[model samples]
Structure formats: C-alpha cells, structure tokens
Target chain A: EAGVTQSPTHLIKTRGQQATLRCSPISGHTSVYWYQQALGLGLQFLLWYDEGEERNRGNFPPRFSGRQFPNYSSELNVNALELEDSALYLCASSSRLGYEQFFGPGTRLTVL
Target chain B: QQQVKQSPQSLIVQKGGISIINCAYENTAFDYFPWYQQFPGKGPALLIAIRPDVSEKKEGRFTISFNKSAKQFSLHIMDSQPGDSATYFCAARWGGTSYGKLTFGQGTILTVHP
Candidate 1:
C-alpha cells in the first residue's frame, strides 16, 4: 500500500503572503496530522484532524491552521508567512487515534 | 519546553558495532514511545515503538528498552551498518485528549563508519 503523499514537494512564498500545503493519507487511514520541522530541528506537532474534525493543535500561532477533508486528506495553511516559517511541513496519517503514524516526504516551504 | 530530552547530539560508530541513543521524557502519562529514523531531506520513518507495559521490544537489528518508572527509553542498533546512519528521534504520546499527538526529542545524528 502507498504511504502518505504530499503535494508541491517544494514551495516558495514571500513574507506576509499565504501558503497552502496538501496531504493525502494512505488508504484505510482516518486520522491526519501536520508537523513542522525547522532546519536542524526535530519535528513539531502542528495540528491533528480525525474524522474531518480538528482534534488538537500545538503551541504554534493562530496563523497556522489546517483542515481535513472527508476523504482523510489534509491541507495546512500558513497565513502571513514569516521568514521563520521556512521549513519542512510534514503530514502523517494513522489508521486510528493511537496507532503508529506513517509520514510523507513533506513539502519544503521557503519564505523569502 | 522540551518534554522529551535526547542526548549525544551526534554519534560515531564503527560498522558492525553497537549504536545506542538515549531519551528521557518528563511526562509519566506518556505511555507510547516510538523511535524514528530520517535520511537527509526526507521525513522521519517509524523505527520501532513500545508501550509502557513492556520493558523491551526488538525488531531485526533494532531494539527499544523502556524504563517506565524512570520515564526513559533508549534505542539500540546492533550490528550497525553504514546504511543505518541517519538522524534518529525518540518520541512519546499519551492517551486521552493527546492520543495522536507526539512530543519528539531533539534527534541524534549517527554516522556508522565502514
């Protein structure tokens, strides 16, 4: 079976602009999660969506938001992007709430 | 605040030697511990995981030793190979409300020299 897949393998945007990243979960997976990995840093949880509802989010600012579709696909949107936002945004999916997560290659977002 | 703390920011191990990475968590509520391996420019992949009920779990050459009372866990790679060189991360997650969210460690870059 295919693992999680992300779109726009790489993205570029200017400060104050908006950026949207997409993710499709593996078949039979119902939970989608978003994480941000800054250069030389570990992954930071961004958001979690289960059954098309926002479950929980991390300590990130309000500008970082995302939603999951009925099909278990997810989109992470960053508004007023800052230079610090330039990082790898990863998406993961799990079959259930407490199962192991399968991650995608991630979308590298560069803010200029 | 870093809930999970990992040590030995970088490690160097000879091929066929043993490589060990240690991590300690602050939250006793965290019951699920997992280790992830990531290559350059790639997302982290789950290496192995264990629950609080078990003290150890091994898969192939990878093993996880968990200490529930100490709130610590360590990943040991036996017969390490150059192909196993990568950044390893230890993570923890608790059930109920934080069920699917994982708190990750800073990560350890391992280089296995052949």
Candidate 2:
C-alpha cells in the first residue's frame, strides 16, 4: 500500500502572509494528524482530524488550523505567518483504532 | 511543560559498537512508548516501540528497554553502523487516541563512525 503523501515538498512565504500545506493519507486510513518540527522545538503536535471533524489540537495558537476531507486527506493552514513559523510540517495517518502512525515526507515551510 | 525528557543531545559510536539513548517521561498515563528515526531532510520513521506492560522489545539490531516503574525507556542500537547515523526521538502517547497525539523528546543526534 502507498504510504502517506504530502504535496509541495517545500514552501516559502513572507511574513504576515498565509501558507497552506496538504496531505493525503493512506488509502484505508481514517485518521490524519499534523505536526510541526521547528528548530530546537522537536516535533510538536498541531492538529488531529477524524471522520471529517477536528478531533483535537495542540498548544499552538489559533492561527495554526487545519481540516480533513471526507476522503481522509488533510490541509494545514498557518495564517499571519511569522519568521518563527519556518519549520518542517509533517503529516501522519492511521486507522481509527490503531496506535501506529505512518508519516509522510514533510513539507518544509520557510517563512521569510 | 515538557512531559518527556531525553538525555545526551548527541551521540557518537564506532561501527560494531553499541549506541544507547535514554528518555524519561513524567506522565504515567502514557502507555505507549515509541522510538522514531529521522534522516536529514526527511520525516521520522518508526524504528521500534514498546508498551508499559513489557519490559523489553527487540527487533533486528534495535532494542527498547522499558522501565515502567521508573517511567523511563531507552533505545539500544547493537552493532551500530554509519547507516544508522541520524536523529532518534523517543515519544509517548495515551491509549485510544487514534492518531496517538505524540509527545516527543528533544531528539538525539547519533553519528556512527567506521
């Protein structure tokens, strides 16, 4: 089976601009998650989506938001991007009942 | 608050030697402990995992020793190699959370020399 896939392998945006990143989960997976790996911050959970609903989110600000489609694909949007927003944004997927999450090659976002 | 703490921000070992990375978590509610390996410019991949119920779990050349009573876990790489050079992360999650909502360590960069 194909693994989780993300589009726009890398992104560049200026300060105060908006950026959107996309992800496609594995064919049979129903749950999608977003994570941000900023410098020195390690991997921080951003959001979780299941059944087309926002299930949970991390400690990030409201400017960091995302949605999951019925097909289980997800999109992460960061508004009013700041230079601090530069980081590798990863997407992962798993079955609704599973604990194992398979991650995709992340989209590296660089905010200038 | 950082729920998970990892020791030795970086590690270096010779080929055929053992590489050890340790992590401790404060949350007892975290039942699933996993180790992830990440190559530069790539996403992290699951290397091995263990639950609180098991004291140890081993895969080819990779082993996870779990100390549930101490709330600590460590990853041991046997016969380390240059191919194993990368950043390793220790993560924890609560059960039944579907996506698992990982709490990750600061990451340990491992460099293996020939």
Candidate 3:
C-alpha cells in the first residue's frame, strides 16, 4: 500500500500572501494530521482531522487552518503568511483506532 | 506539560558501536511513545514504538527502553552502521480528546563513522 503523499513538494510565497498545501493519506486510513517543522521550532502539530471533522489543534495561530475531505485527504492553509512560516509542512495518517502514524514527504514552503 | 526534551542534539558513533539517544517527556498521560528516523529531504518513518505497559520493546537492531514512572525513554541501536546516519526524533501522544496529536522533541542528528 502507498504511504501518505503530499503535493507541490515546494511552495513559494511572499508576506501577506496565502499558501495552501495538500496531502493524501494511505488507503483505509481515516485520520489525517498536519504538522509544521519550522527552523529551530521542531515538529509541532498543527491540526488533526478525522472522519471529515476537525478534531484537535495545536497552539498555532488562527491563520493556520485545515480540513479533511471525505476521502481522508487533507489541505493545510496558511493565511497571511509570514517569513517565519517558511518551513517543511508535513502530513501524517493513521487508522482511526490506531496509534501508529505514517508521514508524508512534506511540502517545503518558503515565504519571503 | 506536552513537551518532550531530548538530549545531545547530535551524536557520533563508530560503525559496529552502539548509538544511544535519550528523551524525557513531561506529560504522564502520554501512553504511546514512538521514535522516528528521517533522512534529509524525506519524511520521518516510524522506527519503533512502545506503550507504557511494557518496559522494553526490541525489533531487529533497534530497542526501546521505556520508564513509565520516570516518564523517560531511550532508543538503543545495536551494532550501528554508516547506513544509520540520519535524524532521530522521540515523540509522545495521549489518548481521548487529545488523540492523534503528537508532541515531538527536538531531533538528534546521528553521524556514524567508519
């Protein structure tokens, strides 16, 4: 089976612009997670979606939002992107009843 | 507390030696502890995972030693090889309303020399 997949391996944007990143979870997986790996910040959970509902979120700002589709794919949206937003955004997937998570290659977003 | 503190941000070990990385988490509610390995330009892959119920779990050359009361865990790679050079991360997650959310520690870069 294929692991989690992300699109637009690299994204570029300027300050005040918005950026959208996408992810597709493995088949039979119903839970998707988004994480931001910013420089020196480590990997921080951004959002968690299961069964098309936003389950939980991290301590990120309101600008960071995302949603999961019926197919379990997810999209992470960063509004009013700042230079600090330049980092690798990763998406992970797991069975709704599982604790093991599989991650995607991530989309490297560069904000100027 | 949802923080996982990892020690020795970087590690160097000789081939055929042992590489040890330690991590201490602050949250006692975290029942699942996992270690991840990541190569540059790639996403992290699950190396091993252990629940607090077990003190140790070993797979192949990797071993996870968990200390539930101490809220600490360590990863030991036996007979480490050059191919093991990569970044390693320790993560923790709780259940219930906080399920599906993982708090990862600052990664440790391991460099194995031949």
Q: State residue A15's C-alpha deviation in candidate 3, in Å.
A: 0.6
Clashing pairs in 1: none
* Tens-digit lDDT string for candidate 1 (B1-114): 889999889999999999999999888778689899999989899989999999999999999999888888999999999999999999997677676798899999999999
lDDT of 1 by residue, A1-112 (tens): 8899999999999999999999999999999999999977678999999999999999899999999988889999999999999999999999876469889999999999
lDDT at residue B49 of model 2 (Cα atoms): 92
Candidates in descending lDDT order: 3, 2, 1
DockQ leaderboard ranking:
3, 1, 2
Which pairs clash in model 2? Answer: none
Candidate 2 wrongly placed segments (more than 4 Å): B96-99
Q: Interface Cα RMSD for all candidates?
A: 1.1, 1.8, 0.7
Q: Pick the candidate with the highest lDDT.
A: 3
Of all true interface contacts, what fraction is found in model 2?
0.71
Model number with the top DockQ: 3
DockQ each candidate and list the results. 0.81, 0.70, 0.92
Local distance difference test, per candidate?
0.92, 0.93, 0.93
The reply for model 3, stretches above 4 Å from the true place, is none
Relative to the unseen true structure, what is the C-alpha lDDT of residue B72 in candidate 3, on a scale of 0 to 100? 91
Q: Report each candidate's C-alpha RMSD, comma-separated, in the order given.
A: 0.9, 1.3, 1.0
What lDDT tens digits, residue by residue, belong to model 3 across residues B1-114?
A: 538999789999999999999999887778799999999999999999999999999999999999888889999999999999999999998776787699998999999999
TM-scores for every candidate against the unseen true structure: 0.98, 0.97, 0.98
lDDT of 2 by residue, A1-112 (tens): 8999998999999999999999999999999999999998999999999889898899899999999987889999999999999999999998996788889999999999
